[model samples]
Target chain A: MSDFTTWDILRNLLLAARWTVLLSLVSFIGGGIVGALLLFARTAKGKAGPAFVKTYVELFQGTPLLMQLFLAFFGLGLFGIDVPAWLAASVALILWSAAFLTEIWRGCVESIARGQWEASASLGMGYVQQMRHVVLPQALRIAVPPTVGFSVQVVKGTALTSIIGFVELSKAGTVVTNATFEPFKVYGLVALIYFCLCWPLSKSSQILERKLNVAHRNH
Target chain B: MNYTFDFGWLIEYWPVLLKGIGITVELTLVGGVLGVALGIACAWARALGPGWLRPVVAAYVELIRNTPFLIQLFFIFFGLPALGLRMSELQAANLAMVVNLGAYGCEIIRAGIQATPKGQFEAGASLGMSRLQTFWYVVLIPALQRIWPALSSQIVIVMLGSAAVSQIAAEDLTFAANFIQSRTFRAFESYFVATLIYLALAIALRQLLRGLGWTLFPKRTAR
Candidate 1:
């Protein structure tokens, strides 16, 4: 067995950090698109739409993402269609992210005062037109801080994909640790990589939260 | 194409699955209660403690908040043994759950505490209450009442996140489902059932917490 220096381990971890960043972006963007649809369905006035959205949210939010990953990866094989880890992890994280993003965005949309919706309706604006012209603009402002905040959650969540052998940051750490017999160095580097990835997002979320609060207060 | 899905394997393993569910609930409840206590303490320490200790509390919260729970679990279960502090997988997993929940709880509770109106503290002080007495009877209690909803939801999140402890082979619901799947080759069925069970537990826990909140914070009911 060969002992690796700090530079060697840091270099490998930084490389694995790329996959973590890629997975976070893929899941966040994919989840945002799907979540927007779900948010629309949730807010739209219809019999079946609300129930379907509720079930969708509960199904994803109620269960653990790790199990969802397992179901997507291993469970699909039972149906005789093998799924690559990339596809399975992407699909699962997207669904998981959508559930959360939909709820966050819905809260933002709903926080718009009742008077705004009524005024748009009084002007003969249709539902879609009203939402497009009046409601969403205000809601988007309220949504900014939470959306940025939840992104930190999305980044941390990509760690679960490692359990399914997708070879993102955490899995890469495991491989390096086993080979080098340096769990402390390997995992410490892993934590530092994660910290480097998450700290900015965390700090920015706080800053955005304060700025939004100030804006709300000023208005 | 024709396909068949069999769920008969569930019948043979129902007892085992039920036992796993029981263990899952036990772990979540134990972890949730202890975590809330720890969270409350951490929140209080950060909010009202000496100036020198503020950074210590902040660092603890941030370190746990930023890292994924899986690595934290590995450190406790796998890494601690190297330091001559051997713990069984279950003990280490349970300890890690409490610590993780405590960090999150601290942040949420601290927010609630900060949001408390200054008038309440003044009122308590005017009634000839000591600082300790005033904090307990006036600030901390009411602060908890206000943040109970957020606190309970965080506990539920901790409970759901507890599923990750299965990575260390904790014999929780997920671990049991994995075992049954390997033995019976009914991966989808086993996991589907596990998912449904988890959903039910989450809903049940939410309702339970809501009821507990109602009982604990009767004064808020009038509002």
Candidate 2:
């Protein structure tokens, strides 16, 4: 009854996959920037800074990403803001990813040891200088694997944005499924596409983890 | 800024909200228990079971870990019907959660198992214990103790992700939020309340898991 050949479905889903990749990139980059700021605040030697960052991370981490998308989509509407689905999805994902990234990075930062801080302080280094020069370089090396690993999550998260009507790969699968009456094939292709996107990231994260931890392995 | 925030719909929709929460909890309980059990079996397969099973379990872990939970749910709920395997939305949701968590739990539990000192296995052998008995009595408990925190986090994560089950009309907590919003046209309020309830549930689940850890591994708590 429908004219959606296999090629047609594949082509449409591929087109939508572009948006999935783009959204993942946008949120990962945006979340990285915000997460870095939160990481600094969280690691800084102050009561309020750590507490505030903690609450922000906990709030985002505790709630469902779907609910976060809904709030961004509709809560903004209550304030006379014309929120588009893409905007809501991007903003919500950025915030959500930032929370996780901040927490992940906090662990990396904390692993740098209190001795490093004391030694830096003994050299008359301020907190900023110590962090910029002494701590971050070490933390950055440790953080790379986990950060890359989290990109897989960001990519998968873009799937949830389809519910908010962003028309990404998963949404395209649904649309194509309706048109072609081939739910199994369409969804199977969708899963295959996601696995293709995600597997490399997961593999590289494992490789990076092993490679980066070589120094500690001897200990 | 003259908009008034009204939550009068809460009075009427409380039952719906309660049912949603109940279902969400039920999903988490069943998913957590079965998923971890499946994880244990897979972990054993990968770590100590037959050599042929290692690659099979590895592939399953990688496949589930790499894909989004929603697509897995969709495959089970919508895609499987094409092959003549039919089930209710809740069953599909439960199955998806179990599958998703099992993959993750396998990885986490495997890490714990790998950390087991070689001496422990030999000690079990010297004690005249069979391989399975050695695994059950000497290996699994300590391994579980080591990875309990990570497993707890994954379970909580699976619970939060269960929100996606609502997309297939599984009547989860997120579904309640969607239903209430559609009925009352209070989209923001409905989602806001649901989000808070999710936050509460997450906190409660974490605490419960921590308590369970204490109960299960009393030696660790005593330390």
Candidate 3:
């Protein structure tokens, strides 16, 4: 076994962090699509649709994401589906994101007043039209800060994907640490990389919230 | 490929699941209580401590907030031993939880502090309460009361996230699931059951925290 220098460890981690970023992007984008559909269902014209979506959100939100990833990794295999770490991690993460994003977006939508909805209805606009022209425009404002805040969470969350053998930044940190016997240097570097990724997002999210004047204490 | 799901482990491994649940609860309790207390101090230092200390606290908050808890745990559990600071698995897990939760709890509590009107602090001073007394009676309590709901959610999030603590062999709920599955060849069933138990815990915890929040600010909630 050759000695792995700090530079070598950092180099390998930088390569793996790419996958972390990629997984975060995939999960966020996939989640956005799935979440939007769920949000619509949540607000659809009936008690049943909204009720079902509520349970769906609660189920996802209430359980540990680790368990979800485990199930996705093993459950599919039990059902005769060949599960790769990448595929299982992606699917689990996307579902997790979808549940959370739906809840976040729903909260944003709910923040829009009843008067706006009624006014839109009185103007001969249907539900979809009302959302398009009035409701969403306003809800998107309140949604931006929290959504950005949640994205920070999503980035941090990608680290958990390493558990199922996805070889992301965290896993890379472990591999390098084992090779170099320099856990502090390797893991510190890993933490630094994650910080670099997340700090800008955290800072900008606060700035955006201030700009949008949506930094309400309650949220 | 004929796959059969058997739950014989439920009866045979009841004690294992119970033990895991017990350990998880203990970790959450310790982590939640100590973490919130640490957060209160950090938030205070950030808001009104000596000018020299503000930047230090800010850095701590930012660093922890930005990194994943898993890395923090790994660094403490695996990396610290390299530096000749050794701890048991349980110690490492609890320390990581406290540190991670403290960072987040600090942010949440600091937001509440920032929202407190200046007049309130002045009121405390005018009443001849010492600075420390004023902060305790006026600033910290009310801020905590106001932010309790958000803090409650954070506690649950930390608890849920504790599942990852098992990765380091802390013998929490997730560890038990992995243990039982390995013994029974029923990974799916084990994990599925674990998820349900976690779901129940999360829901129950949220309710408990909400109740705790109301009790923390009886005056505010009485209105």
Candidate 4:
């Protein structure tokens, strides 16, 4: 029964909002790095590399982010290691985002016509050189829109980390609501804050998607 | 440290796991079917409804699309109770799932609807068909047939997303994993099993949707 004003609640939520932004950045960056390697492995065209990467992507994408967070938090304890909330949340999101980003970028890489690889090979470029020079440049353009769109997913995904007591925006809303006993106002603000964080990226993703579609059509 | 992984716990708790899997499948199937129906309606309204209604539907789509499903579940489960609307966790979870899956499905299906050629509608109109008849006979079914793959994939995504409902204690597979982990202190093993269960369910659901599509759209089978 605390008489906390709406402004006080929002002020606290704004502070917690910083963690949400930080977590999204960490997960997206970490996932981007891991996902790049995974995309490479998936397209490596070897005996077992493709299969291994396929399994990795399927494992993370097929399950829930909440379960992934729980496993990262509590599962590590079973291996005689205790992870902090920050590390656990980051690790789980990185893995989750990696699975998705790998799939997305793989689509980009694969969309490059077969002739480009063949032509690169004919010029005596090794696999690494061909990928580094020829394929990646072309694929990066096709990859931009989807990657931006997927970032929205990554941002929303960080909210799941709050389940493990990570104290992001959603968790902070819970804390504020508990103190104020104003679930409607608290959650409405929570939704609005999330919308503010996500709407710009969402709009840019649509714009990028349309622009890319036009470019692809013209080409 | 000599720690033995007791998969014996898994063996003993097999029935609980099975029951959990059953509940997960039930929720996903029920939610997926209903969500698709809701999606089609919303998509139709957004695409063909009166001008004023279209923007409102668009706003609904955007609002739900950008927010996390977990928070939506909380708002329904926790927030509603404050307004004297008491729902069990399962009802709240299902309602949230339906709302969430519908918004996504609406977007995908609306794209499909727009892709339908205008000529098809003209042909239906030339036959003296009413607007509803033209939409149903000429537009809706054919549009869905073309977009069946995307629509089915979205259903699988919905099924996978159902795992988020566990936070409200829906006793889905993830919830069961949480219970098993606490009881046996084998969090890894518990979640590994749960993940496998989810994978199996996803594959099965995809197959089921494919079968349903084949049955519904026999003429499109050649494609």
Top-lDDT structure, candidate number: 2
Indicate the residue-level lDDT of B186 in model 2.
89
RMSD of each: 1.7, 1.2, 1.9, 1.8
Residue A218 of model 3, lDDT score: 52
Instruction: Give the Cα lDDT of each candidate.
Output: 0.86, 0.95, 0.92, 0.87
**Cα lDDT for residue A119, candidate 4:** 98
lDDT of 1 by residue, A1-219 (tens): 677888988888888889999999999999999999999899998879879988898989888888899889866666678688888899999999999999999899988999999999999999899889999988988888888888888888988899888988888888887878777667777877787778788888888888877757853
Q: Candidate 3 has what TM-score?
A: 0.97
Could you give candidate 3's per-residue lDDT for residues A1-219 as a string of tens digits?
898777888899999999999999999999999999999999889899999999988989899999999999998798687899999999999999999999999999998899999999999999899999999998999888888888888999899989999999999999888778888889899999999999999998898888887455555
What is candidate 3's DockQ?
Answer: 0.77
Model 4 reaches what TM-score against the true structure?
0.95
What DockQ do you compute for every candidate structure?
0.60, 0.86, 0.77, 0.64
Model 4 pairs whose backbones collide: none
Q: What C-alpha lDDT, on a 0 to 100 scale, does residue A100 get in candidate 4?
A: 93
The order of the candidates by lDDT, greatest first, is 2, 3, 4, 1
Residue lDDT tens for model 4, A1-219:
557988999999999999999999999999999999988888896869899988888788777777788778876766677678888999999999999999999998999999999999999999899999999998998898889988989889988888888999999988998888888888888988999988899999889888877767853
What C-alpha lDDT, on a 0 to 100 scale, does residue A156 get in candidate 2? 94
User: Which of 2 and 4 is the better model by TM-score?
Assistant: 2
Q: Interface RMSD (Å) of model 4? A: 1.7
Best by DockQ: 2
**Model 2 / residue B153 / CA error / Å:** 0.5
Query: Which is better, 1 or 3, measured by DockQ?
Result: 3
TM-score of each: 0.96, 0.98, 0.97, 0.95
